[model samples]
Target chain A: MVAAVKRATQTLLLAVTGAVLLRMAAGDSYLRYVNSWMRWPLIACGAFLVALALLDVFREQGSQDDEHDAHVPRAAWLLFAPSLVFFLIAPPALGAHFAERAQSAVVPVDTSTEVDLPPLPEGDPVPVVLDEVLLRAAYDDGATLADRRLELTGFVSRDKAGTWFVTQFGMNCCAADATVMRVAASGVDAPPDDQWVRVVARHVSGTGDGGREEPEVVVEQLELIEAPKNQYR
Target chain B: MSESTRQDSPPSTSGSTARRAVGLPVQAYVVFVAMAALVMSQQWLVPRLDSPALATWSTIFVAIVVQSIPFLVGGVLLAGVIATLLSERALRRLVPASPTLGVPVAGLAGVALPGCECASVPVASSLMRRGVAPSVALTFLLAAPAVNPVVLVSTAVAFPDRPEIVLARFLASLLTAVAVGWLWLRFAGRVPILHRRSTHDHDESTAQAFLGSVRHDFIHAAGFVVLGAMIAAAINTFVPRSIIDGVAGNVVLAVAAMALFAFVVALCSEADAFVAASLSAFSDTAKLVFMVVGPAMDVKLASMESGQFGGAFALRFVPLVIGVAVLSAVGMGWWLL
Candidate 1:
């Protein structure tokens, strides 16, 4: 009778946990947090637990071997104490301290694309760059080529002499394997480091030098925005 | 009259029944709950901490667990098939005789069948039941996971800028496995627990044997994996990153910390290189230590050793492996990295 109760308890706990996790996985933001590989084991373990619980409920106790029983050590319960304390008091999120201490590896930039810039409207405040025009051209065939207004979204990566690259980190695996992608913007107000923002810019692509290639994007406007929950690409 | 006399053997019948009663349900229950609790704890603790360093740690942990599942599944299935289907004569033929040859050969052979550390325990246990030498089986258990191709490839990928680190890891782990095997053969005395069989018998048919063995190995291994992960997650949550980083630079301190990290993280050999790579703050030597010691001696491996080889044997064996792995890593790091 005691064994049956224990088995039922286990089954209930596992079912509840599995259902919660599955719901979490099916939610829109699930892909942002966990990968497909992680889901399989949890599902498998839950299934196994349910199977065992059913077996325990129906199988004759005397016929079953002691080896098949669920006997946990008293010491195992002590393992839960630390985790319980932690769940009650959540730790702080990753901060600038990590960025400061981590090795400053430079992100390699590719500079081979060409862009064409339209003339800025009379009395326009911001200067135009070449790369933005190329980016616009690539995606939209330079249609709706507006010298009046344009917009882009990314994080402030670096600030240099009136220019900054709005950057985002792309991850292939976990956060450990993240790589940075950036677009340079000039003539816009530079945001604080690592701040997420949207920028409105005049699209301008630079003409290739006779022997040199320098494609740039000139930003005409900048607006800072709130950081997303997950910062990785 | 002769048959009637033989039927009066009450003592033998009762003795066998008592042994069965004592062994079966107790082992099953202990193994099951232990496994369940351990796995569940890992699931709970990994998400709550949320530090970048912890994120890297969690990735390594997950990768190790994820990568090993296929091999573990394969090994358990194979064990089950062998146990149930293969005749005693066939099993004997399959296992190499002569401990001297078997131990070294098994250690070297680990390179060919690359798998994660989690799979090695069950495979080694299965091999032992099939008549492989304990010393050789132990050597393979230590070496195969450390020096397998998948692990080495992952290590290479993790340290893409440096090719030599991969080679260094392979050499150091191989040497460590051989050394552990030699030590075990020389000093280990009459260890009966290492060879204990709970329910495996030669009489079982292949199909029944296969299913039983697979179920047994899966439950046993999965339980320890969960236990280890829980301990790892708990440690990850409570222990500050600064504490790990504070002692990371000092040579002696770094070595000790790496050894402890190996124990705490319990990452698979293939995935550990990536974890080491992400610890860019630590010296190359420290990272080397992390790679070398992690697969050989960690919480999971210790739990597994205890479960397979008995608590007493594991108590002795784990510390010895830790000591040797640490020293070898330090020496190799100084020389190579």
Candidate 2:
């Protein structure tokens, strides 16, 4: 009886786990946790687990009786926790709350080759990645960003001083290694915390050296937007 | 079916009455109800709970677990192959008897496993269960995530200007692995965890043994990963990194801080170099310590090690790896960086 219960529990756990992975991978929800490239690998892994569970069932059925029940440690049951948490919490992507804690982080750039800053493409309110805006502001002596209106999109985050900044996380592998990038938006009433927004702004010179203090920008326009498909770059 | 029919009778008359009322055994009925409750909570109860801190914690926790599962699955599949197919004679031919020779070979062999630190624990444990030397297996465990080609290339990419940073990381990690393996050989008296076997039942067919080994390895390793991820996520969320950054001025303190940061954040080896490089406050040597110490020992890896090996083994092993890794990174940094 104990052996049967154990086998049934294991099978159920594996099937549920695989099903959840497939469900997450089949939709955009997985982008909240990992890189987009991981979709196929996740699908493959889920399929493999489900097949393994089925194999276990068939193998057990073919056998006569449980004489030597394989010992599964109590720790194995912890496998259910992830599934339980996923179903219960439905965790969103790392956002304003996470960015608030990890504020004003500098993205790693190639410092060895100091090349000329690329000229901004011919456009008013040029759409730019938040990291590049900060990088050019800090490192480019030419002040390439001066007199150029830029368009930036990020979620809203506020520091202890109640200063609002447009914040985005740059992820390398997963959310675990995400780094915060912020550009302070002035001359505007702040949107709701964690609200994704698009801002057309020009750099506010003399406000930041981009060391600990993030560069400031005077917002010419602000529009609320839904979170992007991929929240991290 | 026969076992359940013969052995599953209720213990009491009252229990039997309830079992008949449910039309299924109590255990099965309870499991069904619990699952249904969990599913229902997703819609009705969980949404009303409004705490940003808790939600952030859950996101990070889920991310770590979800990110690690694929790598863990790959490791167990390889371990399953090892458990069923590899013969003791073949393994003996591959790994030399002398610790002096075998340990270095194992460290070099870690280059083959091009995955995260989470993957190496089960593979290393499987090696030990197959009668490989514990010291040698431990060396592979430390080196696999740190010295693999993917990690090295990622290090190079992270520190694009300083090509030496990549070489320093590779050499330092290898040195740490070998040094710790030799230390364990000399100091470890009797680790019962190495002797505990999850080898296949002799009566089972080869296919059954393979499947069973995969399941066993996956369950043990994955469970510990969840435990580790919870602790790591809590620390990552609660602890302010600015406190660690404040110590960057002093050389000794900076190195220690970086090592501690590496252990707590528990970043993947492929991604950690970028993180280390981003901390512009620290010296190059301190960054080296972050890269070296992360894959060799971290909160997650320590938890997994304790689960695979024994708690006593992890208690002894974790600090030793950290100490050796710090020394190695410092020495290599002075030489190469």
Candidate 3:
């Protein structure tokens, strides 16, 4: 009888888990809304538990005989009790404190190459690394071409007067392993730290003073923008 | 058919009658509610905790639970089918008699069939019923999740820069599993729970047995998975990561910390690599230990163990695996990357 009951419970749980996964995959708005509010993974777990419950129900009805009668130990139940209690109470989200401590202090970049001379089409976005910007003038041959403007969008990673680096965080698994990829913006309005923004700039010639490894972006304009929904890659 | 005739009498005892009337229904209701509550809570909680860190953690947790469901369903079903279709004599013949050979073979079998921690418990139980040596069954239980192809592949993917971590995890988990099994056979006596008679005396047909086994395995594994997820969710909510980090920093302290993490996290072997990778602050060794030990020893595994092997056996066995796992992880970390 005990075995039957256990099986029934397990079936019910499995069915529910499948349903929840389906819902999540379907992009249920409520689920998405709640995902924004809490953690989506927790929702996924809840769904799995429901599926398990359903599996249990099915198993109980199907298997009348208890050929596999393994007795559950009291100690195992005791061990499981505390975890159960904690699940009942929803925990807070990870905060900014982790962000500061988790920041990778060392930025590893190769600074040996110096490639010069490529004119971008009008209004085309030019990819500039910090090291690349330091080698030559921001603009080729010191001439500000007519009707040319570069527009770029990224998060405000670092800020200085008239100069800042727009950066994005790339994630492999979770936020815990996020790496920052930054681009320098010079000749533009600098925003507050960590604010996502759009910058409109005219490429200025590089000073050639900054180390060949650390190039700077020279922006002619900058504007702050709202942060995107998903910050990590 | 013969067993059915014997059971028709109902054994005519007041205690047995009361147990039949009250025990089954009460247990069933409890299981039902437990299942409902766990799923409901997980659904409700996950969305409310949104943050990149929280989302990632939750995603890893969910993926683990989600990915393993199919396998768990299959394993439980297979076990149930075996129970109904195969006669005791047939099963005995299928399993090796000798403890020494059986245990190591079972442990090595884990290298082939990778399952999540929850799935393994039921599989282990099924093996016990087939008359495989308890020690051997135990070895398979510990090693299957860690050494399986899916988990190994996932580990490799998670740590693309370091391939050696995958090899290290496989060797360490395999060693721990075999070592524990050998120890159990040498030290432990005959376990009573495994000796319990088969419940299916009805002489059900092969097809029925197959369906029944599938249903049974699904239910059994599903319950444990839910239970495990709830535990992990609870830990994520209440236990601060700082505490985990603080404890996991010391080389010796990290092993014990990971053992405890293994108990609480209940991560599937395939998804555990991501979780391990996410803990960038933790030393590679500690992380490796977490991957190796989490699948083998955890609260979910303990529940399944109690259900399958009997409480007395689980009581001694889980801790034994945990200790060996920690030692193996630490020792391997020292020798390897």
Candidate 4:
């Protein structure tokens, strides 16, 4: 009976893990934890777990149960921890609170010889990712960003002095490698922390030589938007 | 099919009747149901988790566990194959008898396997189980994940500007692996870790033994990973990481802080160089220390090793690896970088 329970516990844990991976792969939820490239491995591992569980079921019924009935140790119960977490909590993604804790380091993502970015789109206001905006303002050789209205969207984070920065974390592989990117937004009252907001603004000179503060965008118009399906860039 | 169905179906008996009345056979069932209920109504947790510390904790905990599962699966599969297919005679013949000769070969051989820390734990355990020398297997265990081709390539990519950083990593990581193996050989005496050998029982068929080994290794390693991840999350939540910021400028303090940080965060070996590089405040040496100390011994590795070897083995083994790893990183940092 104990052996049967052990097999049952193993099967249940594997099945639940498989289910979690499957769900994560089929949706955007996994982006919070790992890179998008992990989708295939996640699916493959999930399938393997489910298949292993099925094999256990066959073995359990094949008359191998009665002979090896060792007492299930209490430690064996820990195997269910991930199963419980996956089924019950299914923990959420990194949020504003993590953004508040960042000093900042832009990982040099492109190792190949530096290729110039394509010419900025011509318009009154252009849509740019929060990361691209930060990268260009800091690293770009050309001053293509001068006097151009750009639209940027990210969650709101406010400093102690009642200034808000349109902030986002750029992730390379997972939340573990998440780096903070903040663009100070003026001409608008602060939105509540963690609220998704869009700002139509132009670059404002950030004269600080130190790395902490990046260029700001002066908001001409502010609009709140729903958090996107993929939270991390 | 009938037999399986019979096993799952509850027999009509007084004991089962009593269980049915109470909705379970033991008090543990009430706790399980309560946990499930708490999960269903997790709104209360959201408010408590709204704090930055808890939120970061949750994110990191989820990240580590979810990120490593595929690699752990790969490890278990490799281990299963090792247990069933690689006969003890073949393995003994394959590995050198002398620790002096075998250890370096095992360390160099680590370059081929591509896995993170968790993946190597089971494979090492299986090798030891199959009658290989403990030193050789342990050397491979540490080196395989930390110095593998995938990890080396990732390290190269992460530190492209400084080719020396990549060289320092390879040399230091391999050094740590070899040093630990030699230390184990001299210090551990002649006691081999005995995992409960259901190996004899499962030698019935290749397929059966393979599945059995897979079931055993996966369950054991994954449980410890869960436990280790929870502790890491707690440390992440309750402890302020800003303490390391103070020492980032001092070379000695920076190395110490980075090593401790590596232990605390337990970042995946393949992904850790990127993280180390991201801490731009630290020097090249500090990042080297972070990469070296992490894959060799961290919270997750500690738990996984303890799960595979005995608790006593982990207690003795981890600190030694950390010490050797720190010394090598500092020495290599001074010499190479």
Clash pairs, model 4 backbone: none
Flag regions of model 4 displaced more than 4 Å. Answer: A1-5, A60-62, A65-76, A107-119, A139-142, A160-162, A207-212, B1-53, B89-93, B198-203
Q: Put the candidates in DockQ order, highest first.
A: 2, 4, 3, 1
The DockQ values of the predictions, listed in order, are 0.08, 0.43, 0.13, 0.34
On a 0 to 1 TM-score scale, where does candidate 4 land against the true structure? 0.87
The top-ranked prediction according to lDDT is 2
Candidate with best DockQ: 2
Question: Is candidate 1 or 2 superior in TM-score?
Answer: 2
Off by over 4 Å in 3: A1-18, A28-233, B1-68, B81-95, B161-163, B191-199, B247-249
Write model 3 residue lDDT over A1-233, tens digit each, in one string: 22333333334334444555455444432221122322454455445446445544554332243323233222223222223322433222222223232323123222343434455444455543322332233233323322345565666655333345666544433332343444556665566666777776554443322322223446766777876555443
If both were scored by DockQ, which would come out higher, candidate 1 or candidate 3?
Answer: 3
- lDDT of each residue in B1-337, candidate 2, tens digit only: 4234324433453344344445533444566579878788677868775578777888888888888989889988888877789988898998998977999999999887797899888888889888888899999999999999999989888877688999899999999999999988888846557444553355667887788788768767887788888888898788786786799999999999999999988888888998888888899999999999999999989988887787889889999999999999999999987
In candidate 1, stretches whose alpha carbon ends up further than 4 angstroms from where it belongs are A1-34, A37-63, A67-233, B1-75, B85-94, B191-205
Cα RMSD to the true fold for all candidates: 10.1, 4.7, 8.8, 5.3
Global lDDT scores for all candidate models:
0.58, 0.81, 0.58, 0.75
Q: Give each model a TM-score.
A: 0.62, 0.91, 0.62, 0.87
What does the lDDT read for residue B269 in candidate 3? 69
Instruction: Score candidate 2 by DockQ.
Output: 0.43
Task: List, residue by residue over A1-233, the lDDT tens digit for candidate 4.
Answer: 22323445556667767877888888887887788889899999988888887776665333344222232233556656655555445566666667666546544334245656666797778898876776666544325577778989889887667678888877766776677777888887888888998889987654211233566778999999998877777
Per-prediction TM-score, chain B alone: 0.78, 0.90, 0.79, 0.86
